[model samples]
Target: MSAYSQQPALLDPLPLSPPKKEDELPVALQDIVTAAITEEVLGTVLERHVQAHKPKEPRVVALTADSISIYYLQPVREYWYLPLKQTHTIRIAPLLPVLPVDASETETAKWVAEIKDRITRFTETKDAPVDRFIPPNHWGDWSGVAVFMGFTLLIAAYLLGVGVVEQFVFTTERRFNIAVAVHCGVLIKRSKDVNEMKDLLDKHWSGDSKGRYLWVITSWIEGWRAVSRLRREIARLNLLIAAAEEETAKGTKKESKKKR
Candidate 1:
């Protein structure tokens, strides 16, 4: 009779019922990876809620006195900064999952793989923005102009000398030719051409007498080639100059509009 009647008056109440699973827990964050942790670490635990993800290198860290803590972070232009004052304790429960087996042995390996994948996103297929054309001025200094002019005049003079020589050879009479031959013999007494000329001619003659004219004609042709090449360069320069002028005019128009 006493045993049933006096259970210490069932004092301390019937001992409170155990709390619900969630209620009994302290402030707990199960799979939290700090900002200093790699995304791979976070992926192991938390289910990421992202519509659009920012591309960035992973690096997260946790500051702890004894337990974990979380703080709100403000977004800067390219990064986020954690608030100094406000923070709450977070209870860490378990290590996150192995994110799909990093296959990569080292962090560097993972980073390299990530970088390669990211680079693929920016291949030639992407329609990236391009800058407007800016023509370069390369006409060079007065000294460069002077150097070019000097060479041009020298070539012209050589050409003129050659043409003059050829004309003299064609127009001179028999007496002038004979006189030239004799003068050439005296100047080129040792030349084989002189000996050959003496044999070819009915009378004494020297082929070496024609050497000057031959040299001049060949030089004239070379000079003409140089002039032709210079013409092409001039045409290219003209096109470039015209483009630069057009750009300059457009820039002026824009400035005028701004002023108005």
Candidate 2:
């Protein structure tokens, strides 16, 4: 046979005629991948995200999953259901580079070294908060982590007692997207000052964190520094509140003296 004629049959197109279907696409999705996958997959992809990129003792903003819990370090941080039931599409980008079949051990090591370098891309979602304005560090606050609902409730109680939040909310879903942990009451009662704080949070606090392992903020990885920034922000805000109160007091005192 000629060289072209002698090509392996595997390279040739199959001769069988295929059956044709209707041109109309199905309206409903037969499979809900996230839901269907839930049991088979050991956990959600947050594990993959963390395993690849080790964030600062990595305290970032608390996101909403509406009550589903997962141990952050256990490689299953959080999950939510998507009810897409049509011929739509979602794109996924993996953090870690796929190992080349012929890559050397040195190459593998280098790839591992690049994990931290790859963090920003995975983190900077459209609505993801920025990590630009971490306040100056001081001490002794671990309020970075909380039992998601539990912590917010506690804060609501605290703020309510302090008279900051008269009417409050527990979940932050309606206000911000992809939060790690936030002031629930502040979201509910959005004042100009609160908006400024929110702006600071948006620009400074990162949602890329060690993650709330079991909804508790105890996983301090490389992302720990970020938590310190969060703490510093709390300190700065406290100082500002103090300064505002002092100014208000001074103004009142000056007015009283003038009246006298």
Candidate 3:
């Protein structure tokens, strides 16, 4: 017998069958597989598809008492449900043109009142979409940091020179105390300005006082020089008012002299 014939018939390898056609798959399975393949080929295909099909108008849904549900249209059609009791904060952009160049005090007051009323309504409403416009945080700007540091160093140098001058009129301890006192006075004045801003926000933005307070603090950090300039203008206005009163009294005296 041949060597091949000596091998056992049971040891013969079986032939493999051909792969199944995609069309041969069950309808449901075919759809699933097709979707997976499409997703693999086009990254974020589902998100694009949803966006293409989604309605132009936004949808508002009223949630049940213990849970809040959010549906996102982008990155995919997804649903998120969170406990209603969870603390959540709403961020808003600082309203620009806060006071118009030509705006009167009454107009500014009315605008603030309207904003407060809107915020109050937003807090009370359920499942309302809040449009947020976030302003860029300028504290992280390197240019701003450099300018602030330069100004602070200049102020320190000037104060140090003043302290040295005081040494001629005061003891060493007294000179040091005076310098410290002057620096502290400047800071105290700035703090008072910040407090005034906070009070104004509290009066007009009662709904989100914390947010308003934070905005004021950030504004001071970014624009303390501007705040100081505004304070100076107010002082000048007071001086003008006093001068006007003096002029009116002198005119009255001149009229009395003419009558005599």
Which prediction has the highest lDDT against the true structure?
A: 3
What total of clashing residue pairs does each candidate reach? 6, 21, 0
Q: Write the residue-wise lDDT of candidate 1 on 75-162 in tens digits.
A: 3333332222222332221111222323434653454344333222212111111111111113432344344455445444444665
Give per-model TM-scores.
0.18, 0.19, 0.21
**Candidate 1: where are CA atoms >4 Å away?**
1-221
Whole-model Cα lDDT of every candidate shown, in order: 0.31, 0.31, 0.36
Q: What tens digits encode model 3's per-residue C-alpha lDDT throughout 11-64?
A: 211121222333133354234333332222222221111112222211111111
**Order of candidates by lDDT, top first?**
3, 2, 1
User: Which 10-residue span in candidate 3 carries the lowest summed lDDT?
Assistant: 59-68
TM-score leader: 3
lDDT of 1: 0.31
**What residue runs in model 2 are displaced by over 4 Å at the alpha carbon?**
1-132, 135-221
Q: Please report how far candidate 1 places residue 32 from its true position, in Å.
A: 77
